[model samples]
Target: MRSIIAFFLFIFLIHSVQAAPLLQATISRESQVIGNDGVTHTSVFQERMYRDQNNVWLERVLPKHHQHSTDAKNKTSHKHLDLSETAQHYFLDNKKSTRLNLVLPEDKTVIHLQTVDIEMLGLTNCWTCVFSIFDSQSVKKMKITQQGNGYTWYESQNAKNKIKIKWAKLQPDQNPHPTSEYYATMDSIWKIHLERICRLWGLNLVKE
Candidate 1:
């Protein structure tokens, strides 16, 4: 009787370990057109968060360039992106959203609240891969294309300031599927931008 009880207990523990619940989440994205002239602009904001799970959020925002200018005295030039003096309001959900502004001026009119179909990246809830039973190979191999608006926002010295947004609809290295190719290709592109942005904003993404 004792031996049987111990055996059952061990089996129950094993089952419990293999049957953990998956994390639930909600992801959203948005875009905006700014500046009075509207000739130069930026858009594209994305957010990912867990709804049923603990509070976790990741966000990325991009603002457009308004106008480019140069300083006469120093012969140095700077691009003056346009903005009102209001914080731009972007609704991520029915009750949740965020307010964002350009980084340079730090004080300007924010793009107002508007209904825009900003392409947001939705997280794949694949926590089950922790269990040996769940097939995680597909998640690793399968690729999805996230199509949406893209833009560049920056401030630079007049002579060297050249901003261009180059995004790949597909990647360089060929994949069995076109979709999968961009998956591997996008990392390098994103890394370059992230590094540049961090340097320009005086922010250290990786801790020393």
Candidate 2:
């Protein structure tokens, strides 16, 4: 009789847990990276990600806008070659979070890290799962204020150059995929890179 009662209780617990939805957060950030090589890079990256303590995955396409690079050695001519790409990323916690395995099925890449790392945004992950704390707002590790549609963030400021590294997070129900609007935005930012396509279609970059 005790065994029967315990079995029913266990079943009830499982059903109650299943009824609760997973906790997911979307983190979006736009900022400039000042390289030690004396070059600055501007990137606008948005990610729609999912996480529930132990499981995480890239659900949909996240928008990305990255301006090309420059080197002080080549500062005279400053060649900017913007690039655009598409991919997906997923991760599963296996006993530990620091020893998580990052899976980029789209690019056929898997990384087994020794420790939790919070670096290289919008590059390594297919879409964006979690790069240490990047997928979470706590990644900022700095003070922020409530902004119009999102929270204003800044980890540091370059007073000499008058540039304050800023970031923001906007919560929206819409998931942006590889839609026409996305292409138009990328097409404008990378006009030179997409010159061939623009020429073929005889279309000009939309200028605001």
Best by lDDT: 2
Error of 1 at 95 (Å): 1.7
TM-score of 2: 0.32
How many steric clashes does model 2 contain?
A: 2
- Model 1 TM-score is 0.19
Residue 5, model 1: lDDT of 20
Give the per-residue lDDT of model 2 (tens digit) for 51-122.
333334333333355322446774423232112222222343343433333443323333443332323332
Clashing residue pairs in candidate 2 (N, C-alpha, C atoms within 3 angstroms):
88-126, 89-126
lDDT of 1 by residue, 69-135 (tens): 5466755354542333111212123233322212222322222222231112122223232111123
**Global Cα lDDT for candidate 2:** 0.31
* Per-residue error (Å), model 2, residue 73: 38
The TM-scores, one per candidate, come to 0.19, 0.32
Off by over 4 Å in 2: 1-20, 23-26, 34-40, 58-95, 107-109, 116-208
